[model samples]
Target: MYSSIELENVEPRELEEEAPTLLSVGRELKPEKMRPNVWHYERGEENAYHRQGEQEELYVVLEGTVDVTIERDDERDVITLSKHDVLVVPPESWRQLRAVEESRVLAVGAPNVPDDGMLEE
Candidate 1:
């Protein structure tokens, strides 16, 4: 069996006014091993810094640009991604994404574990 959806047809999740619009593609598709989400961010908006306990995540820039800040141990790095760029983040790396322009990104996490994320202040 297979599932398909046009991204524009997916409903966006209701979140804080400052938060990016989120579309849960995996929720709609009912994937067993992966969670896929799409994020629509306005320029200058950002997500919280957070890390997963056991699920690695992949981020793909689908439109515009974003800066991904990753912190591990005591070190930090920022990587800029334009359309079509991709980044794979390990489970324990603290990371956040800021929109450099109005942007859309696809994030997918493997193993589809519940409550695997811990957000930082």
Candidate 2:
């Protein structure tokens, strides 16, 4: 039988890493085209444009709010994503994200992280 766990002086660690002058999580995500890898996307305070590969992806909101833009051949769709909202991004579509209020999002993709810039838009 599994024993009940007990808390022991647990505390949240203070993050000390400096924010990137130019956000490149979009580029960093290019090579890691796999699922189950958790990425902490710092607030860009601006919109970031990107696209997914052949693999499917799911973006789950962890904190704050964001606006997700999905681009198709004929039309562009924009949706507001807030805490607890899961956004599914299909392959071969142009996507961008804007942190509405210092938000945090989790992106999960299948297979391997696709090569950066798989779509042209």
- Candidate 2 ranges with C-alpha deviation above 4 Å: 1-33, 37-47, 114-116, 119-121
Cα lDDT tens digits, model 1, 27-120, are 8998989999999999998998899999999999999999999999989999999999999999999999999999999999998988598887
Model 2 residue 38 distance off true place after TM-score fit, in angstroms: 4.6
Give the C-alpha lDDT of model 2: 0.59
Q: Whose lDDT is greatest here?
A: 1
How high is each candidate's TM-score?
0.95, 0.62
Task: Estimate every model's Cα lDDT from 0 to 1.
Answer: 0.92, 0.59
Assess candidate 1 and give its lDDT: 0.92
lDDT of 2 by residue, 1-121 (tens): 3222221222222333322122233333344436533333456553346676576778887777878889978679999988999988777788877776676666767766544436344
Best by TM-score: 1
Q: Which ten-residue region of model 2 has the weakest summed lDDT?
A: 3-12
Model 2 residue 53 distance off true place after TM-score fit, in angstroms: 2.4
How far does residue 60 in candidate 1 sit from its true spot (Å)?
0.5
